[model samples]
Target: MRYLLAGPDDYSLKQKLSEIKLSLGDTALLADATTLFEGARVKAAEFKLTVDALPFLTPCRLVIVTGLLSRFQPAGGQVNKASRLEEADTFSAAVRAAPPTTAIILIEPELNRRNPLFAGLADILEVHEFPVLDRSGLKAWIGSRVSLCGGAIAPGAINLLAQYVGADLWALSGEIEKLRLFAGSRPITEADVKTLVGYTGEASIFNLVDAVIECRLKPAVESLEALKAGGLPAGYALSMMSRQLRLIILYLDLKSRGEKEIEIRRRLGLTADFVWRKTAAQAARFSFSRAAVAYRRLLETDLAIKTGRMEESAAVDLLVAELASGAGLETRELS
Candidate 1:
């Protein structure tokens, strides 16, 4: 039968894709559009996705078609607005005539619920877009997986990881396996989780923030080292910080407008914990004016790094110093 797995949660899509792979075992063939994205521009990548859910009815199978086909992969050449419109019309038609299969995969840029895809589906399992798994849902997902695998990741352990890992299921699951092997039959502990996975796994993007938040400048520097060693590019790392800070500013702005947290999410287009993280980051000790100052600093440094005036590693160092000053961590350092 045909399937339409469309949702705002990309991680959900990735997780489902992973599950499909697992269910099909080692023998099933998988094809996805992500590979083509690297070599082809948006308009030039000709993609019409169709897979016989049973490529051959003789054996149990899983045929997957990802949603990346509809997305842009950073076009290298000039505009072809005319060709794009034509492609959209063609793509829309293909979605209407989906084939039957034991399973079909859809993902990214969620299908419009009001659109025809939703109406045509035999079943639509509305997966909660879990960038952060709630307590109940966390137990359910982890519990079920444990039952399937004949072991548990433990509820307490799951929450501890969730505090840092959030809901990137793959990373959480990876850490779980690592912990499971380390613990064996013994119950997993937070210390064990930390000792094994450490902050590095869930820590890189946010380590500097935590360091800044807690006013630990030296740790921020060390975090810079860890992030770099972890193969996170300097510019991309700085960009993440910029995004966090700018989002904080946006959250604060909406909060000032008497917006409820949910309203802020709707207005800002932010997910739940993202909104919480921003509020938590900017709420205490730093006002909008202070955040604005820091925001401007990030903007300037981002440009300077892109233009080669400052390297991102050095920029992160400077930014941390400024944040330390902002949070009243060590004002004398900048002076």
Candidate 2:
């Protein structure tokens, strides 16, 4: 069996790979029969030899190659056109001639439709693309995941989970399992989700933003400490802070243009009413000039951490203090 598993939905792709691995019989025996090639740097001759080799002490073999198809993708500039075409043809022939007892799975995070290698094997490969889910799809997936884990969730809880986690299946799956174990015999409710998930990092972010915009130094420091304790990396926390400030600026700008609330929410892609309300309130409190200064400071802090001029933790602490102090607020008109 020849398969092409492509897409950015890594969790589902990995699940599919696991299913394939289990279908081959005993896990112990399959381990000996399985071969993995990680990168596109794998030579064609080496790949062919592995797939062509008979299974050792097993009925079948599994050959998994990741990023092999991406090497021939046109935008990468790794291989010239002529060389790509030749190598693609070579790989195509090898895939076609793979032994019936050998299951060859080619994996890529994404593949260009025009890639010669993908195009050549389109007819024979059992192609599966796992794109990120949309809103409705995410809701459905969350419900299904809960049920699959032997737990039921209320409709409101499903919506809340979808809003909190978005399309990151790995996080969604982990959250679902956590909720299932916590819910016991009863159905998971919106309150449970709120209590357990706590908006999946957004709650701390909101508190942090509120503290900084309100110039509440103690609260800002506490919120930053809570985020660090929750295992959010300093860089990610900084990015999220920047994102919130950007949203505040956007909300103010759109309101100034006389755009309606609904239109602004739609444009900003803020689907959750809770999130929309919070952002609107923050925008009301944070002037455009203040938000811009905070954003600029975040950028500088990011650069300082990346350049090793300041430690990530200390830099983030300083950024929170500087923003909370309203250091640059006097230079610009508050409005």
Candidate 3:
């Protein structure tokens, strides 16, 4: 059987691939198109394919191709006998003629429905791009991973991990694994994560907020540069940093109403640890009005980004500088 699994959701596609490969037994031959193409100059001396190469793909033979037709060839154009594509056609034709025992699995392939490969394949599987998980997916995925590891991910810890990791499943899965080892007989706790998992930039974006909240210029600048260096998207940097500013503003508004940390946490649906840590940070640093000003600038940054009035990265840089500068720059031009 021939198969194609292609999309931006590489993590899930990879998981499905692992299962499929295990099902294909010992006789499978896995060959990547790029690898073979690169090796073809040397390989041509030993084994050359002709129209006769088609029958060689036997049952249980697994050949993997990635980015095969996307960047590699022209569709329905006149096939030049001299080109690498013609060579690919020869291999593909051979696979088509082979028995059902042969499996051609393409990984993250970029083939159009109109392409020749589409006509040749017996089966097609479409995989979707995994969106950033919202609150519900986070809880379920954490619960599942925790159960598999012989423990439970505490209810309170979910929000801490969610706030800290955002929705990057790649990063979250690894963190969950580490917690499993550290967990032993203990239930996962926010303190355990603080000590073990550490504050990823996802969590530490708040540090930059706290820095700006305190108006510590140097550290705020450093934090912004660190996020950019990590190749964080300009929109993402602004969003996360902006969220921290808003959190401060919200915490302050509630605090003035004589709301205690626990009450504030419950009202916001914040996990206990987040409310304690974040509220304490707010109390130590900001007044409501100052936080409001910072948040408005971040809101402006958000607008400029969405409206395309400023280029994405430049908008983030400008906002970071504005936030980092200790003096209130609201009276000055931001853009």
Candidate 4:
């Protein structure tokens, strides 16, 4: 009854966790029998003691630990190298001796195969890894989820959802449910998706960047407003904008060197075809001077927010206004 779930796809991992929760049945009993430990902060001794405890009014106790493997595998200077090594050895030995009635679920975003935990429990633990999906895989997953919900979707609609949603399964899952209710017995269409999904934060950030590069005041401001309404944090949006600007700079450099699409993708480690194409096109649309200026402005805005000089929302509003006003006219007065 021991499980190891590792992956970057939190949505799928959460779904697996939900399935286990459902099988346990009584909500009240689950609260009593489950013990949760954050691997980084929790001590190794506490975890082992919890695993040895008996179930409370239930047949099995659920023990979950996250980030244990990564913490054991350090990146740089070993501040507590000996302590971490001891913890890893203790965790491995404790799990191996875990009671038959305990269900231990170990979760990590990335697990080191060389870790002692894996080396020792490799034979006994049930491991599930959820990797990020490709475009085709995402399309198929969306279609399957729609079918499971007793809903239908046009092929184009499926493509559009996958494109807009990107690879965040959690966001895609929520969107699928929303689209299902919106379609209401009708097969979901491209138009339906366009109207309902609009622009996800990731997609709209591109629009915002594109608008700034083109000096399209209205669209830039509108895109920023849409992102704000969608509850995307200002810092997160700024970081994404900064990343897009950097990509545009790199794309220009690679293109200047006669690197074609494939070479550029390989150099940038961009797996998604859509991402490469969109970035290349956006980079082409803006001059290097403009891109550099935008990057600098994003840094200033980021600093201002972090230093408490401006609220996150207000900083974003100012940023949009400034980007839109590059033509020496108020963005609000633009058509």
lDDT per residue as tens, model 3, 168-264: 4556677888987888788899887767765566555865675676566776676677676667776787888766666767776785565655677
Alpha-carbon error at 54 in model 3, in Å? Answer: 9.6
What TM-score does model 2 achieve against the real structure? 0.62
- lDDT string for model 1 (64-166, tens) is 4443333321122223355454555454444344343334444433343333323334244333333334446755665565555555566676656655454
Q: Report lDDT per candidate.
A: 0.53, 0.81, 0.59, 0.77
TM-score of each model, in listed order: 0.45, 0.62, 0.46, 0.62
- Candidate whose TM-score is highest: 2
Worst 10 residues of 1 by lDDT: 33-42
The sequence of per-residue lDDT tens digits that candidate 4 reaches over residues 1-335 is 78899876667888998887777667578778898876767787888899988887887888888767756765431334465666677888999888987888998866667776577688988889876575689899999999999999999999878766656666677789999999999999999889988666767787677678767688678777767777887778888888988998887778656565578878888787556655765764565666667777788899999899999888988887787668442222312
For candidate 4, the 10 contiguous residues with the lowest summed lDDT are: 326-335
* Residue pairs that clash (backbone atoms under 3 angstroms), model 3: 54-94, 59-101, 59-102, 60-101
| Candidate 1 segments exceeding 4 Å error | 7-12, 18-64, 68-104, 114-136, 139-149, 152-156, 201-240, 243-297, 300-335
Give the poorly placed runs of model 4, Cα more than 4 Å off. 76-83, 200-240, 243-335
lDDT of 3 at 120: 43
Worst 10 residues of 2 by lDDT: 71-80
Global local distance difference test of model 3: 0.59
